[model samples]
Target: MDIVLAPLATDITCAPSTAVGQGGALIEARSDREAITRWLIEYRHSPATFRHYRKEAERFVLWLEFRGLSLDALRRHHLDEFEQFLTNPLPSSHWTGPTRPRHHPRWRPFRSGLAPASRRQSLVILQGLCGWLKEAGWVTHNPFALMRDRRRRLDNAAPPVIERYFEREWWCAMWKLLDPPVEDAPQRSRFLIARRRFLFGFAYLMAPRIAEISRARMNDFRLEEGQWWWHVVGKGNKVARLPVPDDMMTLLREWRAELGLSDMPPPHDDSPVLRALDRRRGVTDNQLYRVFKDGFSMLSDALIARNWSQDHPLIEQLRRATPHWLRHTSLTHQAQSGIELRYLAMNARHARLETTARYLHAENDEWQRQQARHRLSRIE
Candidate 1:
């Protein structure tokens, strides 16, 4: 197993100052390995962040080793070379497709070329690491300081290459497939899939991020003056109250009844809204994502098997869908409905109203495209 691919944060058996046998532990430079290990250990409070930082750090370290370079020996030019490598990994290297499991023989740090945003993020992490090393007196200077400024100006930028959500037809298909035994299945299995339907439906209606949805407690929802609202702690720890659409509220009531609970949640109930498999605890973000992906994959496969054209755009989108797409789909659909921008922003818990405004721009662009398509077609 590649040392870089070793379980991050949990494997402390590797020596602090050297490679761990044939596993090829990262931070290979003897002078800086111990310090890097200590820095990683500090992230125990946030395992996900630790894992992400470790992967980027490990990639840089291994790249250094591949080029017979060390952290202390790096210069501005060397950093440029590393940036280039991130954009296009060596074809002959062990890296596999991004989806390959960690244990795969061909697995490499990068599965594909990093997009502009990803490349920038990777560089930013390295810059922060260099700054930390400089502050700790391990390195004489931060090499990142020598790198050119690459700050992103989000304003006036064109939309991303891919719109990360489904169209109405595909979206409705996804929703419909959530119910009924489309094919023969056991009662117990069907019941659990019903729970998954509610999860996805709730996600679509609320437009909540995965973290917010995962952390939701039954008590977080309330019926104030007969209007349903969900209190969520969204990104940046900002607390916001979001209105629950009537249809979503009805779904919630049905789901609660299925769980043998009252249709209306109690004011102070601490029970998780999204329960674990045992129904004894809250679901983690990873688990929530799995539920969504499983549901999506099943829907996609069914659509493909239904004699839908293989090259249809809807099918293509479903094939690449992730949990985040649900949030995007909700917001995009809301925008298309001509909801007030300020209200949409509030519902999304966006810190910057500009973030919410992008949806408006995307909608306008799409409308214009349709008009152009019609105009371009000469009359029969």
Candidate 2:
């Protein structure tokens, strides 16, 4: 393929022409291009990856400045400190998707759950940077060649809510049946709670990733052969079909009509399946999360109001109670409701049995204990 170098940050292509200055030095204002920067862009590493390189390099530069060593005079210790900085730097507010929003309704930082594999990926990139500097004869040695990290704990490689959210029965009642409070929210904000309850009930009950939900346009949903269904694009960009709840079908209808898009916009085949009050901003992963947070918080508040102590047997043993928890509830309810595992796998849209196995995580334990204590109830 022919190399196409887009001029970065300016109108000029490559470097501008330079003539010899009076002192017999080339009149170039900056140094010539390096090979690694070319490779980074050429390898299809995202612009965000390039941004990280600049930031990480700056961090290394700062550490070197504290020790009074310029890049030309930098040594192994400088690179090692930079590695440490990446592992446990200042709290990264730079995180995107679910964790980016500044308003922490709970007034706490999102817990950083970076996985071992992720840290390893970052470390490998740094090592590669060091290797490149050496190969290009820019450095005498690859400083990080011998340096190592105590690999980050294998963390949940998803946003925090993805790890913790589980929809139990108590939570469902709290969110769906009871409308929780929002502090000084605008009239439009009232939709926040409702959005969560129904969306959670609709989607997680069916188990589509937030990405699939966002990617789903009205065209992807259809009444195929008289059944309401969604054509979801799952992980790895694969397509899967899902059945939607009738109540959800209604919610979608009202929400669209309320927004008046039906007048200005076309039918189910013409617009996004999920949208916001403000159409242009679009739906986001964090929006998906904030939907849950509002739901969970409202639910938690409602349960407290209804004369149920957090210590009550039902509430007391609720190990998890976020939106994903509802997913567990949905699956368990289906299992108890006699939905087959085979059908559950398809409805849940999990590619592997082990992935769906997580949905069954607490079910077997809950079932056995319920059966042992209520053995007489099992008799028909």
Count of clashes, each model: 1, 6
Determine the C-alpha RMSD for candidate 1 after optimal superposition of all C-alphas.
Answer: 6.3
Model 1, 181-265: lDDT tens per residue? 3346775675577678888888789998888788889989988997888998876566898888888888888778767788789
Using Cα atoms with residue i matched to residue i, what is each candidate's TM-score against the true structure?
0.75, 0.52
Q: Across residues 229-315, which tens digit of lDDT does each residue of candidate 2 receive? A: 777766545568778777667766655554555522233455665568664345866576566666555555566677778776545
Would you list the C-alpha lDDT of every candidate in the order shown? Answer: 0.72, 0.52
Where does candidate 1 stray beyond 4 Å? Answer: 1-4, 7-55, 65-68, 87-94, 97-113, 128-162, 180-185, 362-380
Clashing pairs in 2: 165-325, 166-324, 166-325, 166-326, 167-325, 167-326
- Compare the candidates by TM-score and give the number of the best one: 1
Worst 10-residue lDDT window for candidate 2 reads: 1-10
| Candidate 2, lDDT over the whole model | 0.52
